[model samples]
Target: MRLLFSADGSSGDLIPMVLMAREFKQAGYDVCVCGSTEFEGMAVDFDVPYEAYPHSYSDIYLDNQKTGYIHNIRENIRHRERLFKGEFELLSKIAPDYDVLFNFLGEILVPSFAEAFNMANVKLFTFPVIPSERYGPPMGLPFVTENKWVNRLEWAAAVFSAKYLFSYNKTIDRMRGELGLAPSRNLLAENAQCDHMMIGLYEELVPPCPSWSSIDYSYIGPCIPSQPAELSDSLEQFLSQGSAPVYIGFGSMRHQNSDMLTRTLVEAARSAGVRTVLAQAGSTIGAEVEGSDDVYVLREYPIPHHKLFPRCLAAVHHGSWITTHLAARAGVPQLVLPQASDQYMWGEIIYKKELGPKWVDMNNLSQRKLRTALERLVAREAFTRHASEFAERVAGIDGAKNAVESFERVKSKLRR
Candidate 1:
């Protein structure tokens, strides 16, 4: 069976695809991963056929020379355009060959493309719950609001962009014309004829799946595995010498004032009287701060939370879904500092599950706030016990295996 998997964004987005690809390869199926050039190395590492697509959101973000909020807004606009163009090109090239297309969440173009190709065996996978019309506030707004303003603005942007910027509506309409189907609202509803809808997040994290007659949606839990990355000897030594340092790191998101964040973390660790390993994901946290004796600011590290969390007293992180799952799996108490996106969701889940305290918004972060969270995480023995039990639950599930099995079933269904 030949399966095509496509995704974009950070390692968090690509890692799940890679894990599923490995499972399919092990099951004696030929799996090809189509994604950004950034994921080519990861595809190769997983022994899957790597097809480098020209579309990349990160490239657009980096290409814009501007910094701070303006940079982010410009990047978002560029990303929307690139996403439409890149997905169109990729679909035209690969839609003919694959028996089934498995798309990750945030893949805005797959449904229309699949309809264009008359590919009935397409599956849509999400790392989180599907958004309702009024679920969460719209992304990239000037300010968040509990009122209807944010959602209205979000819908307005979607309409304006679809009409003018990328002509996404035209593209979809054109595809629908080719398929002899009327134009529909959004890709998910339009692609209701798809064979499966697989959700990657666990039921615990997401609310119940939406009931759709044509789509088969199931909660498959998070796909996680240890990937190989190098760790500095000094960092390793620090971890080995002291009681496992509270693991603290923001994966890829850069802090505007990294020095301030680093200092605050250092002070909090000191106040809590614990060693700390700070995973500096590509961004520097300043030379003086990086040179600290008690705090190790590491550049690259292979220490997955599965391995490190067991040794640490507690963890403080940027509240990414991948990081939250890892921390929960390790059964160590967590203190999430949420910035944006699904970070807030995971942070709320951590507190709801009684695994940690409430999330600390990064914008409002301070030494005292972090210190307080740390103190609570360390002092509460009940949190640790609950965490350990949760860890065992995580260990028992084989997400990779399940993902592969699902792919194979879809492949078999397509053949029939």
Candidate 2:
């Protein structure tokens, strides 16, 4: 069957979706990914069919940040509204007819598109997105409790943000009307939409929650990709020369104060008395290290996590699900600097799970805080032991293959 995956998010969302698409393609199903042109290179590298947005989302978001959307909630909210509306128009124009719509949480409007086209659809989540009776709201909601009433109230705030801040209901209804379909209501009501919900995360890391929604769930672990040969000879040499640097990279989350953030990271690593490999993952952060030994800035290419993490004493990054899991799988302790979204949750989990020092917010991140965190990150043997244990557990995970089996099960079960 042909599948259209609308995953117009950053690397955390796109990379996993690309890996999943690759698996479906390998399984003899027609698959295509729709997303930012910034990551078109990754899709092309993986040999997956890709549709690109004219401008890179990173560029667009950075431009928005330049206008001070980073601090103001109102402007930030409206900026996102415009961004999604633009995406909706693009998808409606360019998408091909497909049997299934594999939608990402970021492109929430794609499900309405799927409904309009009469396509079988599954919502994809790299982490726990569904609000549950046992847990609470997902995606970094500050409070989660055992009380059903309390959780529901917190979930109302999330739903309210979707409605007012992002205009999710208005957008979905608008699209549905254009397609001559029924309007959507109660946008995130449990099982309000979606034929199935597939979670691509490590089963061991995900906390068990009782079902609050009837959508068929496929916890097919994380779609961890094979590392590309992106590391240069000079980069490899730099890694071998150090007493294992603290590898720092905030995957895709942006900061308007890029210069200050970059300075803070460099200074902190230096203060911790460790070598550093600062990965400028599409951010305007660092200059390439020519012969500097204390810090080697990676500006040209993304540091391959699988290859580089094992060589690092610790990793300091935005704790996106894929990054968190990969760092864990590589037996490296981390200093999670959460910038936004579900990252805060991952940072907290990493800390409680004893994988790293406490997670600090990027806005509040400083040389002193990071220095202390890195000192703990590099010196603690307990972290190494826990991280190694986690590594062993993840070493055998084949999330792509398992995700394909989940697709089969969902397809077969739904047909019956």
Q: Judged by lDDT, which candidate is best? A: 2
Model 1 compared with the native: what TM-score?
A: 0.83
In model 1, residue pairs whose N, Cα or C atoms come closer than 3 Å (at least 3 residues apart or on different chains), thus clashing, are none
- Where model 2 places Cα greater than 4 Å from the true spot, the runs are 62-76, 93-96, 133-150, 164-168, 190-192, 227-230, 288-291
lDDT of 1 at 69: 45
Q: What C-alpha lDDT, on a 0 to 100 scale, does residue 318 get in candidate 1?
A: 74
- lDDT values for all models: 0.66, 0.73
In the range 1-416, model 1's lDDT, one tens digit per residue, is: 56778775667777787888788788887788777876588777778887777855456543442224445545554565566666666767787776667776566556665555656445444433233343332242223322345545554565555556645566656655665567766543343456676667655555552334346665577787766544457766787776777888877666676777778888888998877877776344533565455777666633455666666778888777778887877789898887655566567778878998877877677888888888888888888888988787666665677776665565445532
Q: State the local distance difference test value for candidate 2.
A: 0.73
- lDDT, candidate 2, 193-260, per-residue tens: 57887777776667556653465677777777675655778888998786888888876656677787
- Candidate 2 all-Cα RMSD: 2.9
Clashes of each: 0, 0
